[model samples]
Target: MLTEEGKKRRDALDAEITERIAAFKVEQRKMLEELAEIGIHVEMVNRLPNLPTSDYVQALPILIKHLRREYSEGTLASLARSLAAKDASEYWDELVAMYLASAHRISTGPGNLAMALAAAVAAACPKNRLDDLTNLVKNQRLPHRVLLLTPFKKRRGRDPAVARLIEELRHDPALAKEIGRWKILPSQASLRSH
Candidate 1:
């Protein structure tokens, strides 16, 4: 009952959707089974003096999965200690950064998720191994933190062009809109200040 062109187009569309669904399934399987692909190389996992093939970027997602797997207050610390027995410094920091970013991105209940991981690990494992992690917290800065101090605006040592841009930004719909959505709240007076 259909013309040749019409039937041909319908078949092509069906093929396209089938291709998309198959591709999606393959991608999902690959992601869910990433760590399994590493297999239990007894040498690497058992700490038998062998170099691990450099695959940190590839393995980072799997490592994150292990970290967020519902620790009993100090499970992560225990895990970090176990890992530290095999790996080197700041392993938990790097892993915890990935975990925190995931939790932050998910908008889940752990919103104020302090990297309270070191204490957990220190409790579960030999405490002496993680002094570096304790110090990393002192040195770490939250992402997207910035301080703008424009003393020249008040101290009489500024460019007119910069001043003009600052003034113009108030009226500029694009600039104002962009600034308005900043994560940090800007004071009304300071928003106007150059």
Candidate 2:
């Protein structure tokens, strides 16, 4: 069960993993320090590493300021979610700008920055902003358009404007294929539930 070569390899692998973990911790500490300089305290950042545990009221302006700054995908997603949790409705335009600017870099996944931004917009966007949301869905390229349409899923049932937008998209030949493939958006039945 313990050939010398196998033991050596396992030990080497363990050492590499340990080194990587230590390096990652160092990077996190540096990032935290840099963020602290910009007014994002470590406690708020810690609460936002995953789901937001509390509202970062004092840190909201700083967080919004850095929302569009270059950062790792995970960090961006966390920031978006934290903003959404705080109901940053007043910064809706800024959030939409960030979402649109980052559309090209968005990856297809559940916990990605794009998804978080979509959720943030959904949480913060007002009735008057429906036109902007509709325009985004209509203008964005495939996949991104579909992803952008997702936020409406939560609203389609309750908001007549969102329902109309979904109806319009359903009839668009260009988007039919991509939208049909994923089927992640709200269905007609759900839309009728309200």
lDDT of 1 by residue, 87-182 (tens): 333354564454345333323331122333332222222234333332332232422111111121221123453334334443544345544443
Model 1, runs deviating above 4 Å:
1-29, 40-93, 96-116, 119-131, 134-194
In order of appearance, the predictions have TM-scores of 0.23, 0.58
Shift of residue 111 alpha carbon in model 2, Å: 7.6
Tens digit per residue, CA lDDT, model 2, 26-134:
5356556666775566643425645443434555666676666665565567678777742577889988887876667746332477767766776667767777877
Q: Of the candidates shown, which would achieve the greatest TM-score relative to the real structure?
A: 2
For model 1, the local distance difference test gives 0.37
Best-performing candidate as measured by lDDT: 2
